[model samples]
Target: MTLTKDYKVLSCDLDDTLLREDMTISKYDSRILRELQKLGVNVVLSSGRRAYDIENRFKQIGLEKDGAFIIGSCGCEIVKVDKMEPICTKVLSNDTINVVVDYAQKNNLNLGRNLFHYSIFISQFKEFYYSTTHLVYTCQNPYNLEHLRITNIQPLKVDYEAIRKMCLESPPTKLFITEDPIAVSSKILPEISKVLPLSSRALITKAYFCEVIPTDGGKGPALQWLCRNYIHCEMDEVVSIGDSANDVDMLEMSGLSFAPSNSFDVAKKAAKEVLNWSNMESAVGRMVNRVFFNGTFLMTDEEKADSKIE
Candidate 1:
């Protein structure tokens, strides 16, 4: 449906939609995003990464001041990018965490938790699940676990008992389960959700991940809350873009939903339209162009040439 009003909030996924193959936002993508914000658009960086991690990325790209309505942990946390003030947080209760941990332990699944300000990981093989966790928060999924080892984003390790204790002591914004998505979805998803109360939710974010969260959490519900309570705009005044199964709910709820050509077929199916260009080809810049320039997303030769990531 074409929105009668211009979208106020442009919620974009970080991993694939904005961050290209090298985990860097292209120059063209970066330029156009700030331009849109100048057009009175609030750029919402929605990701499964911790807020601090997301903020650090923005700082690296000099867009820390440009991104607003920072939503993290797959919508379990919402905070303003400028002051890092939290607007909302959904933590899984102790009872629910115990049940999920028991299941993960039995299946030898890798379990993790992201705090609002920090990260805590609980698993038998801490290093084994690094790339998978990185994918949910950063990209489609990293091809090299070795690359993650050299990076500084590793989560603080804690045992299963510690994970459970932390959940009881202080709830996690979201619970991250990294495994074969198909395996988890088919073999473990039903079991995970069956034990949780009606207030909880579980989702398979990618081919190798499952994000168990509060039922009230997820991009769709989070966006609604932000719109109704903070932005005070109608649902039709938001644009959302993403590239994975975790992005489905947000895309479905957006006024104008877009999926890059590289996006999963399932995610493309959920969007209002699909971009012909993939994320590698400045797809986000093109999408922003479409939003502003009457559906013709193009770049000048100079801008196109300047768009290449280092």
Candidate 2:
């Protein structure tokens, strides 16, 4: 699809969308984003990733100094490109956090603390309690309930009952319950919805982990925030791309949304168009080049035919 200046912004999810499996951006993708900037199109990174994590990856892409916008920790925080100052922030209350921690301890489940700023605090026995706690931290889930003291942790709380009610009423931006993300999201989400109301617009993205945020928290809201606050652009002027459920919201909201052939079925269904290539084939790069520069960098039919034969 031909994108017009009305779509002057590009918002995207990170994992399984902009980044390949190795958590790296392809050179072609990086170049296309820079080229889009040259066309005065704003590129915004919208992700559940922490600000630092997103910033580090952008640095690797050699675009860290390009003044891109980031929506991190879901839509709870927004940061300008290269600037430490945040334009927005949302935090849960400490009492609510205490309640969650206590419930997890009582249930023999692992508890992880997201500071929403610097570090993620996990239970000492995280390994036993959570399947992939080891990936995020060195300490295991706490074995002893005696050590479950809550102190000095950044105080944040969300009314579990209220959140549950909200989730049920409306879809959450993202819902994360256990380390086996798909299982929890599929099984637990409906159960949680029994108690909470979810946003109708919420899109669930399952990974090794799950997180709960606003239904609008996906790339869509982050991009909207950037366009209104930073870029002064409109929604119809942007193009978005991704490969998973978390990308659904942005994909639907964008003037044009592209998904790789390898994207999840749900994501592909939501996209306005599907790219011929997968992430492994640098599909994001191909779409960016096509949309922004009218460049002809996509792989040829012969290349695909050769690869399939190999």
Candidate 3:
């Protein structure tokens, strides 16, 4: 069965939706993505990841090219790929970040730090190593500066004071708090919500990671903005796939939505349909064939058995 509506944009979630468990896009998925772009469909990578990392990751799979856009930092910014600059962006205020920082210190949670800028001449790079509990910067100069290596070779005392100073200089895209999942859900998030301003919004992006951004920032809002301004399409002309709390908004906003077999119950409820195949089995590729190609190619025995058109 053919889709009732023609989709113009495919806004996809990164980690557990498009990329497999091994953190690689399958060849089948990559080919479908390329084929979509060739047919004048806009492919937007909407994720909680930093835009820089998303571009780099897509480059490895040979998907980074012109006409591509990124909704990064969980919708705080939108970047036009070829330009390498954000056509639109929103950032947390210094006062807001300071409040969260104080709460983190009081709760004994690790606050992930990142530099707002990366300059080769200054011998600095941005990092998103969210797993590290210590406050450290792994400085690697792109130009191969020998002197810079000595300072970053050992973990410096980049304490809370450093984070405050950095925030004053330039506000961060988002603030991340990492702690035990139970603590994060039970005590940390609820308490911190009372202290933060009403304009601030927070969500659990991962089991142990809570991300705070502007109230208007999120994958759903970002996609709405892109549809109205960039792509010039209605919300009903978009198809999306994702599998987490962060993906709920985008799933609800799309014309057609899909959740993998392993997705959270909340995500599955939000999606229009749940695929039988998981991410590892190229769920995105199979869905693409069914939606755009009318199930003409790449059908497996399991998929044929499970196939039911909406």
Query: Candidate 3 on 268-295: residue-level lDDT in tens?
Result: 9999999997787778888888888777
Q: What's the C-alpha lDDT at position 201 in model 1?
A: 76
Q: Model-by-model lDDT, in order? A: 0.72, 0.57, 0.73
TM-score, candidate number 2: 0.69
Poorest stretch of ten by lDDT in candidate 2: 127-136
| Number of the top-ranking candidate, with lDDT as the measure | 3
lDDT string for model 2 (1-310, tens) is: 2333446777766777777665666666776676666666667777766555677666776664446777776665677655444676554333333343344344434333332323333466221110111111112333212112211123233434444443344322233344445544665445434433343222345443435454335566767777777787777877888777667767887788988887888789989998888776667767776776567544455544422322
| Pairs of residues clashing in candidate 1 | 200-215
TM-score (C-alpha, index-matched) for candidate 3: 0.81
TM-score for candidate 1, residues paired by index:
0.81
Model 1 gets an lDDT of 0.72
Which is superior by TM-score, 1 or 2?
A: 1
